[model samples]
Target: MDLVDIDDLSVTDLGAVLDRAAELKAGSGPEAGTSAGQPLDGQTLAMIFEKPSTRTRVSFETGMTQLGGHAIFLGPDDIHLGHGEPIRDTARAVSRYADFIMARVFDHTDVEGLAEYATVPVVNGLTDDAHPCQTLADLLTVREKFGFDSHVAWVGDGNNVCQSFVLGAAMVGLDVTVATPEGYGIDDAVYERAAELGDPPERTTDPEAAVADADVVYTDVWVSMGQEDEREEKLRAFEGFQVTTELLGDRPLMHCLPAHRGEEVTDEALESDNAIVWDQAENRMHAQNGLLVWLAERS
Candidate 1:
């Protein structure tokens, strides 16, 4: 089994993962702290990360450890994919030693490659096209702040995070409105799938209109990893897209941080009482622990 994108999960399955995450967050287990669960006892997780990270690395490693398992971090320098090794070989090699695989990579195909051959489960840590884990945590955070049905407005680039957010929101029945720059657009297939699920995201170019009545207003860096060369151009295109309080209209704020602070969102909005990013950040561990345990059980 693999979780390459939010679409990999059915509505019920997504609910199960979130429910378990809620339980993990509540510390309902016998032990204390984030590392309380024993669900992955004696298991090993191979974490192959091509992209750099702060939250993804910490949350997964800490979550796996807390779940009674150990995680081995393999960065670009540590992996052969950077040295011309086929991703298939890496997948086969790691699957032999590790009980499961979690990869955060630059290419979506690389994640698909691992899932194609790995005998055990493969979890997507992040990819150029999708980010299932982060969306899971985002949904969990929103579920806590408001109910699952609360309206969410995605107020920036229609990047990978936006794509995955659409799918995750549809699964949990949240109405989403996406307002992005002219050239940027969410994947049509993602939107169509979400539409099939009954809450197709409304697409627009007006950021103000998008978040006008939203319960949660979200944004991401205008330029993500692998898009560094286009920084100046993206910055110009995203000039008026910043998530300011006036545009957000009293709604709670969300950013999957390491935010560009002054660019995509105002500092005041990020630090304001309505900002729930810290809680959103903390839920990454709980959601990931639930995901690891859920996948490990079926595998």
Candidate 2:
């Protein structure tokens, strides 16, 4: 099965993933570490990307390597899909050689098309619509910090990261409040799905109000990968939405890295005593390793 969204997995499955992540985090001994040497000795993963990345590429590639598997990095120039080859055809061909597929692309439809044709499990690294893996890591970090009942307050663009945060938090019974500019709210479809998963999230235009009682205040870059042209406009729109020291109050701060300092967050917030930004970054590897183990066991 493909992991396109958190909602695609049940609450029970989400819990299982997190529980295993915690166990793995606590250290499972030499055998578990050695799983990387023979975990997927004969397996291979095809990682396709149309956009540039730092964490996603490194985390997945390293995770697969440590798991005793091999990963083929397929850049845009190397892939025939960009040269007019059909996504279905590419997916079929790659599936024949790889045990699983992980794609970070500009279009969400491309990931969907690949999944439609591939026989192996497909993981969505990132797209214009969602960043499920990041959300998974964020969830794991929150579990570490404030335990399972921790709440998350998002203070920035209601972009893909925010959408996934809401869905993932709801599935795990965490309260999530999204505060964005009036015109920059999350997609209604994503909100509705979060509600269907369990509890509907609280929405607000005031970032401070959203983070007032939050255990974790999360923020992402004001503009995403494909929205570079709107950087100035987003900066203006998200002016008051930044996670500053005053805004954080007693809440711990979380920023997904490649952070645009002074834009979505201030230097003070990034350097604050309550900041877990680096831990969040490192947890990407641990969380993904657990996810690989979970998926492998289930498969």
Candidate 3:
């Protein structure tokens, strides 16, 4: 099965996946260790990257190694796709060698295409439209901080992270309020899907209003990769959208890192006791470990 979006799985499936993640987080050894080796002892993973990454690369590569599997990193420049190879051909070829395929790319369609043609399970590392794995880690962190059924308030660009969060919240039945700049709201399709998952979310343009009484206030870089040209304009447009202490107003805040200290979030806010930025970052490892194990068991 491919994990392209949260909607692809049922609530029961999500619960099982998360429960397994929690189990692994609580002190389970490498899944393969139980049998005297890695859970994926003979498994091979082909990791395709069309974008630069630090977290995705390190986490997946190390996760695979620890799980008794090997991961081969395929950069855009090194792949047949870069040399005019069709995506279908690339997917079929990689599937022949790899037990699973993980891709970090610019277009969501590319990930979907790979899943379509590849016989192995396909994982979405990231894309311009969604970052499902990151959202998985974020939800696990929220579960740690506030327990199950916690509400999250997102204040900033309704970008890829926000889009994934909406779907993640819906899958877990957690309430979410997203505050984005006018004309920068989540894609209509995402909004529609989230609404279908459960009660319609509370959407607004006022960041402060969204965070009031919120358990977790989340924000991300105003300008994402490929958006460098809009840095100045986005800064001006997102001025009041910053997750400052004032906006947080005693609410705990979370930021996905490589953060711009003074832009999407303030240094003061990030350093506050209520901030769980570091813990969230650290949880990425544990959360992804759980994911790998879960996938291995199912595979």
What's each prediction's TM-score?
0.96, 0.94, 0.93
The candidate maximizing lDDT is: 1
Sliding window of 10 residues with minimal summed lDDT for model 2? 28-37
- The residue-by-residue lDDT of candidate 3 on 23-90, one tens digit each, is 65665456435431366777888889988788888878877786778899999778855258878889
Candidate 3 segments exceeding 4 Å error: 28-37, 80-83
lDDT of 2 by residue, 105-154 (tens): 98888889988998888888888999888888898998888875877889
Rank by TM-score (best first): 1, 2, 3
Candidate 1 clash figure, as a count: 1
- Ranking of predictions according to lDDT: 1, 2, 3
Clash counts per candidate, in order, are 1, 2, 3
> For candidate 3, what is the lDDT?
0.82
Model 2 accuracy (lDDT, Cα) = 0.83
Candidate 1 residue lDDT tens string, 106-144: 889889999998888999999999999999999999888
